[model samples]
Structure formats: structure tokens, C-alpha cells
Target: MAKAKSLKAGDKVEWETSQGKTTGTVKKKLTSPTKIKSHKVAATKENPEYLVETEKSKKLAAHKPDALKKK
Candidate 1:
């Protein structure tokens, strides 16, 4: 099995969207359950998620490490 990628703040990443792929920079790492813009995020220390800001729209979204690709 392929090892999952490890991401950190300031890392450039991209993910799939309805309009196509969206690129952004990692703003923060979430290790605890929390909400972002009304979206519930289930993150834990062992399996954390990322908060990224879109380069174009500056929108924030939470994404799992595996769902993001370094850009």
C-alpha cells in the first residue's frame, strides 16, 4: 500500500472540486474535531486534516491529508 502524504502549513496543495481541481495553500493543521464555516471536521492527532485557503477565491475548507495533493 502507498503511504499517505504528510502535509504542513504553508504547503501548496490541490483537490478535486465540482468546477474542477482547486489549488490552495495549507493555512493550518487540525488535530481535534472542530467546525469551519459551518462544516464539521473530524480530525484527530493520529489522523489530522488541513485547513486550506483557495488561491483564487480565498475560501477556506478542511480536507483530509489523502484528499490533498502537493502542488
Candidate 2:
């Protein structure tokens, strides 16, 4: 696999979903464990997750760096 891209807030990114590909904007980088609603974000400084907001639904989600493609 390719090296994961570095991301920050306001960066555009995309990821796959059951509904197919979805696009969103990075809201924040999670360096420690956190929660999104009832879902626990198992994040770490070495393996962080990104909080993103969907362009359409505006729903919030957390995804690992490798799981997101920076655009």
C-alpha cells in the first residue's frame, strides 16, 4: 500500500461506504481515543483517526488515515 497522506482540518478526502464512495471535509485529527456518538474511536498518536463531515448529509464520522484518500 502507498504511504498514508497527511491531513488537517479543511482538507478534502474520500472513503468507501456501503452506499459507494463518499466525500467529506476533514474536521479534526484525533490523536487519542475518543467517541463519536456511541461509537468509540480507537485512535492513537501513532495511528490517528480523522473526524470528517460528509458533503451531502453532513454527518460526522471517524476514519483511520489509511482509510481516507486526500483530495
Which candidate number has the best lDDT?
Answer: 2
**Top model number, TM-score:** 2
Clashing pairs in 1: none
Per-model TM against the reference = 0.88, 0.91
For residues 1-71, what per-residue lDDT tens digits would candidate 2 score against the true structure? 23347888999898989999999999999999999999999999988889999999999999998889887
Ten contiguous residues minimizing lDDT sum, candidate 2: 1-10
The residue-by-residue lDDT of candidate 1 on 1-71, one tens digit each, is 22227777898888889999998999989999999878899999998999999999998999988888887
* Candidate 2, superposed: residue stretches over 4 Å from native: 1-4
Taking every candidate in turn, the Cα RMSD to the unseen true structure, in Å, is 2.7, 2.1
- All candidates' lDDT scores? 0.87, 0.90
